[model samples]
Target: MSGTAQATTAATGTGGLARTWSSFHRAITTNLAILPTIASIVIFVAMIVFGEIAYGRIVQVSTLSNLLINNAHLIVLAVGLTFVILTGGIDLSVGSIVAISSLIGVKLAQAGWPPALAILAMVLIGSVFGLISGILIQRFDVQPFIATLATMFLGRGLASLLSTQPERLPEESGVLWFATKWKVIDGPKVNDLIVTPGLLLAIVVVLIALFVLHRTRTGRTVYAIGGSEGSARLMGLPVDRTKLYVYIVSGTLAGVAAVIYTARLGTAQNITGIGWELDAIAATVIGGTLLTGGFGYVLGSVIGALVLGLMTVLITRDGSIPPEMTTIITGGILLVFVLLQRAVTRARH
Candidate 1:
């Protein structure tokens, strides 16, 4: 009887220890996935609270919806950027691509082409540009930064050549309907939940991006390439093709962003997305994408974009905070995140 009791006690102790270890492991996993998002959420809440205190009704649903609608294009841009960064690559030409596509689409619309055709042309052009960058980087062993930077200048010049002045989108274009507001019933009759098609589209893209990254073999290859290119090549993982695909994806998304922007602003210019590449990169970094590549999350990028959009709104709402402070704060956050990523990488080594 004594022996049996001892044996039972030992088993129970071992089981308890195992359970505790499992719990700890889960906690660590959860933290790794959520730390970046948590930071964005915390900042978002802080911004909302500050906005409420600084500007009356700034925390209202209408105000929040407006902010999201205004920045939906940036959200898409950031998502595309997140994909490129995940593969240890950068796309410097996306902003210029956006400008070019927007200008081209608007010009085509002005020339009496159907809105659908113009939109398709814009997206295709963007993908073509991305393909060029990918080919250059993969075929020539060019650094991603330098290759994309060259494309950036080319895209910017193309956009400028297309039009010397801002082109207004046709008021009659059906595509503009995407910017139309929809009211989801909330509580009382007039206090409805407001939503924009642009917001819905952004959400959908983020969801699809997450699914692709986490569920597909091609996506896994991207992570693998980012983690170790030499190993990926030895494994016969289609490294060059995969890298090219990522750029194409980024460019295609940028073109879509141009359509969204045209619908929102009803105007396009060569300078429309002049500095947007920086914004997208900043968003990706803030969302926990390692600058050196390999690990990243699309949803994190979405949250990062939201965090930035909210910061802009908050700064605008709070007259006391200088507009320039927004850039400084974004830069600071990026620096901190990069440092943290470096530390984590070094610790692993």
Candidate 2:
């Protein structure tokens, strides 16, 4: 009787220990999953603190305002990217698509097209490009990378055929108003807060993206696809249609970004968006979206774009770091985040 009691006690203790360990492990992985996003927030706040200490006027209303203005287009691009990345797909044609849209919008406006009509055309062009990419990827067996790359080439080629040189929008065109500044807060000593319609558009995009990603069934399917396309198919989700939707969203927003950028600069060139696709990808990765897909936040991408914008402001203020160093810094930051993502993925598995 004593031996049996002792055996039973030993088994109960072992079982309790195993359960405790399992619970602890679950807790750790769950926290780890959220760590990248929290890290991005912390890093952004840290940069602000460092900037304020190291550079005067870093937090001034004017400087802060300019940060958003300068990166408004990038924020839009990153949000679009978040959608595709969340579906475990990529769109390398975004930069090229921007070039095509900007060129078309400007040409139409110059040719006496109504601003609203021209803007609609620009958006439609983006959607067409996105639709092409989606069809190639879904209807056919083309890999996302190859399909987007081919579409990227097609966009650039079409833009080149339109005009190899820069086309300037007329100053009197109604489209230019998107870049017109509106004072928000009249601050002390020329530090007033100002914003543009372009910035407002970007904010609206972010809000919409938030709603779609968190509130809709399509959004859930997007995540499911990213988590595992095979499993998503097995579960009877609308995998094909959802994948198409994400690409279309990405392309359409790329058009919107072109509108924002071209209006601000008053010039559209075939080369206008060269290398911009890489920048958007960097922003997305730095924002805590996994390059492998399935985990990310649109708001996080907003913060990530702001981080890059702030870095640019600091570099300019310092007057020591070359403007080109911005890309190098971006590359470094992207790499760090990618490694962190790998660690998280391992833990999750």
Candidate 3:
């Protein structure tokens, strides 16, 4: 072949390879929203390796159980946020809802109400707040961020106004009983590896979230809206109602998180969920949810929470590391994941 023809052929071949690689990358990233969950497992493995090298017994069943128990609330909160993100919206008020719900639920139970009633009341309060945000954004043309931010303040103020101090729920309260472990597996060593009802609740919520996002028509509509609100609307996809429902679902989940947290702690406080919103957002994002809106996975959020929880455990196990270091590490991971998301998004263009 002539030199010019050879050069052209080489360029064409290179272009084909580049295009293939780009397609593969996009496919993997989009479907691998579940990758974060796997990454969390890998991180745990790495932590175990590091712990074995640094501090023996870091992999003990007691340590793992404690880690899971402590972070169950985070997992639940993350799952709720994932639903909101998948619908191409944000819910900044979940932490506040958590606090408010915790306060109301505990107070009602203390005031001679049945535990079920208190739980219902708490979830109702959360749903109401969510509805307000949804209405403001979907009907009034307000931004989702601004609407949810307003609700965040509203929830926090309500929680604080409800009580300036922590209210301790009685240990004997049936609500607290939900926090106890049921000993499903009964491991031979180190506390039996029992599973707390709170953890099980979180798992159940994750499964439900997965079902809604993947199987339901409403869920598909959510993704369509997120993919393009204008197109969804033009196509008559019930955009406004779908957006409203997304926020409501998020709010209800937040309330459920409050019940889990309150049951586990046996205490409800105005300041109970300070900064928890950031953690939930981070978990959702790190789990591969797009911040620009649309695309997410419940299992990914669970993994993100687990990754964070494991990081905390690792830091605590290492005597040389300060507890505050965990926050810095988490922030770093979130930043990296966000940048990765942006890169993937740009590549699709």
Compare the candidates by TM-score and give the number of the best one.
2
Ranking of candidates on TM-score, top first = 2, 1, 3
Residue pairs in collision within model 2: none
State residue 237's C-alpha deviation in candidate 2, in Å. Answer: 0.8
TM-score of model 2 vs. true structure: 0.91
Q: How does candidate 1 fare on TM-score?
A: 0.89
Name the better of 1 and 2 by TM-score.
Answer: 2
Instruction: Write model 3 residue lDDT over 139-195, tens digit each, in one string.
Output: 998988999999999999999899999898866688887698776566656646767
lDDT of each structure?
0.85, 0.91, 0.83
If the candidates were sorted by their lDDT against the true structure, best first, what order would they fall in? 2, 1, 3
lDDT string, candidate 2, 228-330, tens digits: 9999999999999999999999999999999999889999999878888888888888888887888899998888888888888888888988999998998
Lowest lDDT block of 10, candidate 2: 28-37
Cα lDDT for residue 162, model 2?
97
Distance from true location, Cα of 123 in model 2, Å: 1.0
